[model samples]
Target: MSMKLLAGSLIAAALTLAWGSPGLAGPARPLLLAQASQSAEDIFWQSVQNSTDPAMFQAYLDQVANGTFKGVYKPLAEIKLRALGKTAAPATPAPETTAQDRTTPPPATEPATPPPTQTAQDAASSPDIEACDRAAAHAMDDQKPANLPGVTFDKLDTSAAITACLRATKLADAPSREFFQLGRSYDKAGNYKEAMVAYKAAMEKGHKRAIYNVATGLMKTQRGVKKDPAAALALMERAVDEKVMFALSGLGDYYRLGVGGRRNYPKAIDYYNQAIAAGDSQGYVGLAIMTYDGTGIPRNRNKACDLWQKGSSLGDSNAADYSKRYCRYR
Candidate 1:
């Protein structure tokens, strides 16, 4: 779908959610601290992204359904429930009052109801209820991303898995992590322009990973953005500065290949070392490749193969392939 359409849809859906879009980072929540002009709507959607309690979700939707935004927001609650992989519990029907016509004045066609049995409309009109709901709703999801496969979806728990999916699947959104995930999802889904828009949103929130991601995983290969090696290199550098583990490998590639500027084998090796120190096995692959080519380091087939083996053990896919090729032959 076109970005305009997708964004419009998401915006419409966002207007209805009670807990949030399904995603977290606690201490590094830049969205709440950075954006100062968020409306109640903005605050409300953000809460939907973080919340896990089914009751809370149901209550928020009830407010939307009964309140002023019923026409626009009621359907939104349904969408949110579906996204959560849940069905909204059936609301209990209000009971008929027992006061006899003879004893008490007939209740008005629409009588004032008490707290527990208030209809959706009543709940919606209560600004105080929504305001009170903010105490539980506005909190950012504090859970970390789960370990999902790069190629497959996992059974994600909606409540705590909001941030986890954003970071892992890269298809969801709320704010920083969500923005980046949506960008990645768009890229994979062939919506390059939409991806760029989402990435830009993430970048504005000071997301280092978004900088690298917007540059096409540091390859200068994505569409929508003007692809320049120098620009891509600069973005990777920014991510590396933030100590993003994978960015170290990307920085090494820029220096090793003279992608953005003149080749600096020494700098490449330096970055490779940094990546290795940061526990990214790709660092070993890059450094080993340099060793194999006698670029910066003296040519040492044994040393290169050994590095490849180590990287392979650490789960670097390229290193595993390289190990079979070089270690088997040499």
Candidate 2:
């Protein structure tokens, strides 16, 4: 599926989810302030890479005009707009204050004390973040790209993870990754609404793994998020571009199931093969299904059973069940 940015309202809505409201960060204000620079760069690049639509860059410029992505991405977005043969609308000038208004005395109040500044360590090194990582971090998360054998959903401590991640996300200097973990924690607990909120927040901050999660977990009928399989497919593709290797399996499923478009068996097989090559056991299950059904390849029960056995050995429950039920691979 070709990636495209949604309407500006939707984009802004997603950003609103991240900050709790437009122009207001609520309790997470300090956290957003702390990571603003990196988040802006990440969000800008991700949005730009996912689509070439001029409106995309325009939307970014609009965000900048409205008080986000001020320094770095603003110029870059303008440059992109120029390259695309479009020009950003000029900044709206502030209304000039009249001499009479300046002469009027404002109500008197006590002098305000500035709030204490928070450092990145306040959240990065937080014990709650550590607990969240220990309790719910997915093996395939980009944050731990090198660690591919972490706890599975069934083994996740949903309660503990949710508590810790929730605490971490509220910290004054929390990173976006904590929001991703919070989403995972809610997913494990069967709280789709909360999970969707957390995943969208993480996605807004440019968490690649959260992109995959939002595509697969939320962008479908009957999920907490409104159904939009086309958008989901686009997001999955973006995840692949971002080198979320596990997303290959997701693309395979999308193709095999014809969720966003017509079934393309060849594409499904190709994605599954790529995922398998990347050492994702879930890929084995997808290929096994195709082999067993003779969808794109010749029917080969033995080959399917072998594939399921391999996936089962890699800790995939669906593969284990299939292996046990058909292959007698106890």
Candidate 3:
């Protein structure tokens, strides 16, 4: 887990269940973070012992932004790290200016690589590809509910936020999570090549989340990446070890499809169960499909119907469509 993530979870855990109660205008919210602690144990105690206050942690994070840990506080921001772009890194680092920060800007330029089986032109024109891309982008949209927890458009003020993000990550003392954030920024800007650089750097620094994300990007054939199921599966497994639910679902998909490995229906079922235990909706849909097909497990229409109903309730469109075909409306 990233230190930034640990910090946020720790702070939220510090909240008084009875928030907005008397004496909580601001000051009485949380303050132990006002003073940095000596040890990791104390740090946890200090964080959880205080009230829920993002500002306190934000200030604490700012002060330690360039500290030894390279801690960053963003949660679920890295995404869409496509492999369809430039082959070369920039000659120099971007200036510490806010304006150049990552945003949903226009495509700066396309890489010079020759068109593949599926060119950008083709992808743009193909309704299926366009819809898939839209779904991907929509998942990361900060504006509405994707029904995916721990994900949000936390950096709405792109310029200032990216400035802070870059400044923090640029410090020789900065954490790998900072680079993960940088990759997310670049990904948001549609700079897939640059995003990959940041992801690689984060992975080098042992960021499991970055490994997970790079793996997902590699698996997206529509993203112009050469398929590397084995490599992607390996990375997802690593992230799953860190107890990331996203990685668990990824493993389920990889196992079911035999991507980067042999088709193991049983393993896929297990991974999907793990994700479902972690409250991920994707698991319900995956498990439902496999049960319906009877690929690995016995075909049980009743069980599959029940799973599809659960998944559809969780907002999985595929499960909803499948329900219409194979099972009566729930």
Q: Summarize candidate 1's per-residue lDDT along 1-330 as a digit string, tens digits.
A: 532344345445544242233345333323443243443345444455444434444555655666623433333344445555464354567677665745897656976676565554554334433322221121112211332222211222222222232333232223355555555545554546556876778788666667777655435554434567877788888878877658898889889999879999999999999899989899999999999989988999899999999999987779999999888967
TM-score ranking from best candidate downward:
2, 1, 3
What Cα-based lDDT does every candidate model obtain? Answer: 0.60, 0.74, 0.59
User: Taking the tens digit of each residue's C-alpha lDDT, what string does model 2 give over 197-271?
Assistant: 899899898788898888887456553346888888999999889878679998999999997789999999999
Go through the candidates in order and give the C-alpha RMSD of each one to the true structure. Answer: 16.0, 17.2, 21.4
Residue-level lDDT for 34 in candidate 3: 31
Residue 299 of model 3, lDDT score: 80
Off by over 4 Å in 3: 1-164, 220-225, 312-330
Candidate 2 C-alpha error for residue 35, in Å: 35
TM-score of every model versus the real structure: 0.50, 0.62, 0.47
Which pairs clash (backbone N, Cα, C closer than 3 Å) in model 2?
none
Q: Relative to the unseen true structure, what is the C-alpha lDDT of residue 63 in candidate 1, on a scale of 0 to 100? A: 53
User: Which structure among the candidates has the greatest lDDT?
Assistant: 2
Report, for all candidates in order, the number of backbone clashes.
14, 0, 4
Q: Deviation in angstroms for 53 in model 1?
A: 31
- Total clashes, candidate 2? 0
lDDT of 2 at 109: 95
